[model samples]
Target: MTSEPITVVLGSASPARLRVLRDAGLDPLVLVSDVDEEAIVDRLADAAPEHVVTALAQAKADAVVETIRGGDDPLFDAARTDGVVLTCDSMLLLDGRLSGKPHSPEVAIEQWHRMRGSTGHLITGHCVTRLHRGEADAATGHQSTSVRFSDVSDTLIERYVATGEPLKVAGAFTLDGLGGWLLDGIDGDPSSVIGISLPLTRRLLTDLDVDIADLWRA
Candidate 1:
């Protein structure tokens, strides 16, 4: 590992992901991707959710890596920096179907109704692009968490939908927000369900020869 502490640019705008990184001792700079998520979903209509999610994550990472390579950020100084550009995508797999941002309040309500008392998978794909002197070398890994939901009432689901949280998250819910009460348990890293996985991220950083401790700058 280099004596210099490494910095990271998160290739997403997810507040949850940002919090996860900060809580794990690495502070990341946010750079939202312009990748058309809906278009990617449509293009991979027949693909498995796992593959589709990873593809989207890689696409986002690639986009941001290209953006930085074209010009250095005064803060990041990509041209001389050794850093990581992280991107991730999460989706809930319920009964073999992929679920992401129910979009409409009605859809959120309907999905939550079915999700109650159910067990499903939350898959999050992670991509780490190593920026060495502005050149890119990428590594990727993904995690799947099994989540069990509480058997809540229809009124509760409707009320939660009205809160408008479900409408903006994958699987019409979240583990860190109001949706927490609705979750009975999780079988894997809760952070992955939130947006990113800390343990998995460390492995990816190691794969790219970046020391995870170097990011903490202690």
Candidate 2:
């Protein structure tokens, strides 16, 4: 027996996510989703951090599918009619508020001041969608991990933020880059804090009736 070919579409521009997929042995096609993240965040201001990220992940998946369907791309060629789309969103939960991409040096510094020597939840939402013959199937869920920040001096915080690495990353910190030294240790999936969780993504794909091993084979 032979299986049909499948193409996995990553609906995000985050290099962290791309690296995760590559490490998992899947070469996914990148398609940056054009969704208004701030609009959704504002609309769900009262919702839990997990729920908000989940909604954003779903929105990204929807946007990617809509874009591909509107075009006659070979990704949807008759032979590979059923293609998989994966999208994710992450946020930091600090003092009971959802935060994503500080967007400014001041905001990043402010966030770090409050985060120093504190524990926060790094929540990553995952969505996997399968498109076949005009029909779509999807599964969405979230993964949360506890991140503890190092109690660094104010001078160090300023130095780190000045590097401009924290301004565009969720939580204003990362475990795999310049921010690695700023973390004490994470209590859960380290990949979740970076951007996407491999375990979570595997489960989501299973929920959509897709085999995780197939992705690794690519």
Candidate 3:
């Protein structure tokens, strides 16, 4: 573990990502990047699911970096110097189409119907940035996991949608919540399904010269 404490900034407002970092014993500052995620995704409409998620993650991190740089707050400046920024985006790939967060309960129901009794790929893209010797050292990567869902009934889908958990999550389901009941199994990192992949995040941080052991020490 390093003697110096590193300020880890999470460039997202996701509670799940925040919890992941906290569980890993790192105190991360949350900064929600105000990027037009849907617009960015639209621009890459022809891209693969993995590429789309990766691009969105990078866009989010870049937006946060720019936002911080444009501000004159001394605290923000200090944070930029002493902290690492982490950003991530997730998407679901079913067949050849990308499934995103549902815009409404109706959409959630439809997506759930499509996902019923099917297996899909959950892809999460992560970006980590830190200031090093007058330049920013940024690294971007992604993790893909296969998830199989049990057969779901319309009654269950409607009930889940009414709970409002599906509206804000990619693929219209939360792997750690009531939605887990719909999943049969996962072939990769379960944390990725929740929103962020901790193992992948750790690797990116390590590549950026942040010590994972130090960050994980309670």
Candidate 4:
């Protein structure tokens, strides 16, 4: 059978997520949502970290879907042609407190200091919206991984912060970057830390009747 062309709309500006899609052989169109992340997290003050991430991911996907339906953007046309929209949010939880991207170098340094000699969980949530017959079907889910960090020295944290990678990453570190040096081990999917969990995403797409391999062929 011939493969169907499935256009993918990525509701994030993260390079790591884009790389994941590309490495999986899917060409995803990037759409950075303008939703206020802090407000969303604040509103979910009573929820678990996994729930909060899932909610934020769904919110971002819904915002993008609304924009596509209400505007003349080309992505809307893509959606009309059996495209899929994907959104994701990630956070680090240490002792039940959520840790998102650090706002400044000092914040990154402080977070690293707190994370030192501690084992934490990284949770990433994904939302998928499949547009069909002018309607959208959406699913939301989360993936978590346990990360253990060795005792990090002040000099090392300072040097890593100077690289500027920690500022934009959850937990103030990127497992694929110099931050890997700090990790003693991980207990789940590492890709979840990068923002998108491949296994979780694959299952969601399967439920929508979209074969990920078909997208790779496209």
lDDT of 1 by residue, 103-187 (tens): 8999898888788999999999889999886578999888999999999999999999999888888888899999999999999
Give a tens-digit lDDT track for model 4, residues 52-162: 999999999989888777778764586666788999999999987899999699999988898999999999989999987788998889999999988978999999999
Candidate 2 regions exceeding 4 Å error are 75-80
Colliding residue pairs in candidate 1: none
Superior by lDDT: candidate 2 or candidate 3: 2
lDDT of 4: 0.87
lDDT of model 2 at position 125: 92
Candidate 1 global TM-score: 0.95
What TM-score number comes out for model 2? Answer: 0.95
lDDT of each model, Cα atoms only? Answer: 0.87, 0.88, 0.84, 0.87
lDDT string for model 3 (27-69, tens) is 8778899989999999999987788999999999998888776
Q: Scored by Cα lDDT, where does model 2 land?
A: 0.88
Per-residue lDDT over 62-137 for candidate 2, one digit per residue giving the tens place of the 0 to 100 score: 9998888887777546413678898999999989988899989899999999999999999999898988767889
